[model samples]
Target: MWNHNYEDELIKCHRFAVGLAKEIDYKNQRLLEMEHKYNETMATVCRLKEEVKSKDTRFLEMKQKYNESSATVKRLMNETDLLHSEMRKTQSINRKPDEALKCKKKELDQQAKELEESKAHNDLERRSFLNDIEKLKEELQAQEEKTDAIENLNSVLLVKEHMINQELQEARKESIESLQNMLTGRSKLGIKRMGEVDWKPFGDICSQKFPGEDWAKISAELCSEWQEKLKNPHWHPFKKVMENDEPQEQIDEGDEDLKELKTKWGEDVYEAVTKALLEMNEVNASGSYAVPEIWNLMEDRRASMKEIIQYIIKQLRAHMRKRKRC
Candidate 1:
């Protein structure tokens, strides 16, 4: 009986041990599965940590970029404010010049209007002055015509006076001749003794003396000879006498032809002819002493007193006309 009780106790003990071993094996398997799941979870946790680090780096870069953008925006706003200030100052500075330009434009317009008015006034005055000048010219022409008519009348009166004086001189000469005839106790017909001189013989002698010379040249030579003779102090044609202890000139009876010519033409006529010949020689040493003819084709005769006066008037009128034209 003790052995059987002991064997039963041993069997119970072995069976309990076997059951514990099976529990142990199940616990080991469950633990292995838990460990594998933990490993996988740990790996997932590491990946998550790396993703968070990368995200943190990107966020820091974005924050730095945002700060730089803000700084740039602030600087741009300062520059815009400064530019606005400068524009306002420029506008203020230009305002005065613009106003001055407007004033200057107004002044130029006023000056232009004044200049146009002055030009119109000048034109009107010039036209009026031209009309006045025309009127003055007409008055001057009429006055000149009146003066010319008066001058012509005066010239005619002068010529008539000269003719009257000539007639008076001729009457005085005739009276002198009559007195000379009575003094000489000769007939009145004997007063004309110049015809007895035979002037043709004297002319023939002059022609012989001066060959190839015309009457004009012979006369010039005679005038030169007389001029030279007159310069000689001792070559007096008249006789000299002592009267009151002073020398007096008297007629030279020895020169019958000269005395006859002097008695026939009067002392005044003889002196006038001599003076005229001397003046002609002095004025024209080489040219003819004869007067030029107004009409070369007309008859060779002296111009009448009326003709001479008419010629002088005509010459004066022609000269006045030429002066007016000029």
Candidate 2:
């Protein structure tokens, strides 16, 4: 009976393993599908961008053609006017009345034919231009619609990606907790992430502060104001290292000047700096600010204090992006 019970337990564990394997396979399949969809969307966006460029080029070319056609029409109309002037001058003359009248009438008829031909050609060209313009407008409208669709798709994908990521994390956490529970023979395994950041100050600033101005400049100005308020603050980072009597270990991260300020003030000063950057970044309106790109703008050894601020802001931005992604 004990052996039979052991066998029954083994069968149950095998079934559990199989179910887990099947679930993992399903998750993997879903991940692949999401990645495939993402790639396809990016390709479509690139294609649309190229199409927009081509459309702009075509529009410019059409505009040039239309301008040339207009010039030609103007010249032809002027010629027709000149012929009318000549006819008026002939009518005013008294010499060789019948002969001159007959000659003038023949010339006028020939000129009229040329004028009619020119007018017909101009009308045809105008119609062609209008048709092409209408076609171009249609293309632009279609492009706009596609852009809206892409934006909507991106929004949906972002949300779905978030949900999937959360599900994946929860699944992994549950799996780990299950193994631990089995080993320890406990019903509960306590695990939790960091507490939420207080966004009330940030929200208040967004609501009350400079509405239309460039927030970066405002932040820069605020930074300057803070420096003015601090009677004796290290402007240069290297100065802080030099001020110390004892040689310090190499900093793993952070600018020396900012680090010194942190030593002088509090570590939580970052919250203030971060708040300013967040306001300046306008990330909700735009998207994630690329930190690697910003870092590249400065050569590591030669960057200034101002650049250091930018680097710090970017670091904060990178952190924000990671937090938001998670």
Listed per model in order, the count of residue pairs whose N, CA or C atoms clash below 3 Å is: 0, 1
- Itemize residue pairs with steric clashes in candidate 2: 237-257
Model 1 deviation from the true structure expressed as Cα RMSD, one decimal place: 50.8
Clashes of 1: 0
- Candidate 2, residue 15: the lDDT equals 100
lDDT of each: 0.55, 0.54
lDDT tens digits, residue span 1-326, model 2: 99999999999999999999999999999999999999999999999999888875765565566566566657656765775676668667844456665676576567656656765665676678679889999999999999999999999999999998897656554544443323221212222211112234333453345577665565455455443332222221221244358853333236655555456444454455433333323312121221111112223222233443454466579889999999
Could you tell me how far off, in angstroms, the CA of residue 35 lies in candidate 1 after the best superposition?
99
Q: Write the per-residue lDDT of candidate 1 for residues 63-116, one digit (tens) a residue.
A: 455455455545555554565565467668865445554465465455545545
Worst 10 residues of 1 by lDDT: 187-196
TM-scores for all candidates: the values are 0.22, 0.29
